[model samples]
Structures are given as structure tokens and as C-alpha cells.
Target: MSDLRTELSTNLDEAAWEWLIPHVQRDAVIVVASDLDLLDVGVAIASDNISSVQQWIDQQLMVKPSNTQVGNWNSDRTKKFHTLILQPYVLVQEMAA
Candidate 1:
């Protein structure tokens, strides 16, 4: 719905890697690919678009940060990401420099 989309868009935020560490620790973070729009993904998830969500996951376009990635981000606290929290999950896409 447009209302949901607008709401999600407003909730989108830029967060430093350090700020996101807690979510990562809770295993609540899902990474969206840079090529995709974070809002679109958030809408799909919030609306229960299972097919599309599963398709992205099957393609590895959406995934939780791996230990190596977590480590890298941890080492560089300055890294930033676009984030949208959809309860139980924090959708993240690394911001393009």
C-alpha cells in the first residue's frame, strides 16, 4: 500500500556499523544488495510478499551479514548502511560511497 511504502520510506535511516552491532549480535539483520532499492524490499517484507522475498533470498540478493563481513565492519566502525527496521528484522544495505 502507498501508506505502508511512505511509512517505510520515512523510517529509512543511515546508521554506522558500530550502531548496528547490537542488531547483528541478535541475528536480526538482513542485508539487501546495493543494486536494489531498500524501500521496495521493505514493502515486500512488510506486505508478506513471500514469492518476491523468497526469490531475492534464493538469489542471495538478501542475506544476513557473514562472520567475515561482521568482522570487517567491526574493524571499521566508520562503515555506514541504509537501515529500515521491520520488527524482528533490521533490513540493511551498505550505502554506496
Candidate 2:
């Protein structure tokens, strides 16, 4: 866990919506549920724990941001989200208000 944590920690970052536009443009953004540990999810995906990721996806806990969500973010240029990259997908979780 330490090594994986170290590797993932380096990739963990906070990003504004504008910085993520490229990923969104490519339809590579995934919105992770707030209840889940963002790092844990990254670790799971990084380690290829497909069953865990599949379960989350099946339950709709992980998904692409809805149009409403994108609309809101588009309107608020200053908003930021916790983000992580897992190859083709970039996982994002909304920050607690």
C-alpha cells in the first residue's frame, strides 16, 4: 500500500474546471461519488481492481458528470475539484462546501 500510495499521491491534485477541459473534451472525465475515498478509488483503478470499479459503476457511484453539473461548472470558472488520472479516465470528486 505504501508504494502504491506513494505513486498515486504524486498524481493526486486539485484542479480547476478549465484545466480539465481537455479531458472533458475527450469524454474521459469520471465523477466519483463524494462518499468514496478518492485515493482508494485511484488505487483500485491503478491496480486494475475491475470488480470494485465495476461495482461502483454499476451502482452509479462513478459516472460522467451530468449536463447540469457541467453547466454549473461552466458558469463558475473558479470552482475546483479533486482530480486523479487513471490512464484514459480522469476521476473527479466535488469538494465539500
Candidate 3:
């Protein structure tokens, strides 16, 4: 767990920490995912509610094109939604002051 904590601390940015600081509970495992396709496992989002995440995945997976463009961005830029998997790692939130 120390190794994961160290890794998260080293990798996570201020904004990421800000989001988790309030929601995560110290000594508890937290699953996290992103659109960058980590560990060759695609992308995922961390949340305590697995059912809701699964439902979101189910609804999003139904898209035929897979990738969709939303909002303003470069013409070549596109976004692809990925699946959410239960991560094996656990995250223990740091205590707030």
C-alpha cells in the first residue's frame, strides 16, 4: 500500500488530489481510472458506487461510432469513451487538517 501511495503522490496532480481529498476515506481502498489507457486496461473512473458506474458504461457502450466529439476542440481531436473495470488497488485517503 505504501508503494501505491507513493506512486499516486508522485503521479497525481493538485487538481486530482483536490477532488479525492474530500471524498476518499483514509485507510480505505480507492479505485481510479482515466482516459489515458492505463496498464493497457483502457480508461476508468473511480467511484464508491459500482452499479452506477456500470450503468454509465452500459449506456455509453451502446454508441456505434465509439468515439464522439463534444464541445470545441481541434478538428483532428476526438474523444473515445472507455470501459470501467474494478481496480485491484486500494487507496487510503490522507487525513484532512
Candidate 4:
């Protein structure tokens, strides 16, 4: 695996990360969320340059046709967010506890 894949795999579950690695950019930020009911999952990929990320979402993930230009105030002023919905799972935790 490449360095980016290795780093992301540490942050994400193995199966999910493997599926996502090919579509994610080297410097993008990945956020994985599972709902309280544990029946839904959401993944967001953010980056300053999001063309590749947007392409993946359009072609592979098949998000509904709409504006992709949703902005974020809490994140870096220059970057943006792309999201995907999926099944439930935990994303982050203390790795060596």
C-alpha cells in the first residue's frame, strides 16, 4: 500500500478503508460517522482540491444530482466536504488501549 493508504487505514476500519483507498486523495481529510441507532453510516472526504473526490462520488457512490458546493465554516477556509451514506460502524478510538 502507498503511504496515504497506510495512514488512512490506521484511522479507518480495514474493510471500509480498503474500499475507499482507491478513490481518496493523498492529502484529503476523511470523516466516518455512524448514527446512534447503528443502522447507518456516513463518510465524508474533504480537501482543498476536490475534483477527484467529486468525480468518485458522482461515478462510484452515485449521490443524488445536486449542488456539490456545500461550504464549511469550522474547517479550513479553503477546503470542502463530500459525503457518502452507508451501513453502521465505529470509526475512531484509542488504538493501543
Number of the top-ranking candidate, with lDDT as the measure? 1
Clash tally for model 1:
0
Candidate 1 is scored at a TM of 0.96
lDDT (Cα, tens digit) per residue for candidate 2, span 1-97: 7799788888889999899888888999999999999899999888889999999999999999888999999998888999988788899998865
Instruction: Give candidate 1 misplaced runs (Cα > 4 Å).
Output: none
Clashing residue pairs in candidate 3 are 29-91, 30-91, 33-44
Model 4 misplacement above 4 A: 14-49, 60-97
What are the lDDT figures for the candidates, one per model? 0.93, 0.90, 0.31, 0.30
Task: Indicate whether candidate 2 or candidate 3 has the larger lDDT.
Answer: 2
**Pairs with steric clashes in candidate 1:** none
Higher-TM-score candidate of 2 and 3:
2
Looking at model 3, residue 25 earns an lDDT score of 33
For every candidate in turn, the CA RMSD to the true structure comes to 0.8, 1.2, 14.2, 13.7
TM-score of each candidate structure, all chains considered together: 0.96, 0.91, 0.22, 0.25
**Better structure of 1 and 4 per TM-score:** 1
Clashes of each: 0, 0, 3, 0
lDDT of 1 at 68: 93
Q: Which ten residues in a row have the lowest lDDT in candidate 4?
A: 33-42
User: Tens digits of per-residue lDDT for model 1 on 1-97?
Assistant: 9999999888899999988999999999999999988999999999999999999999999998999999888888899999998889999998765
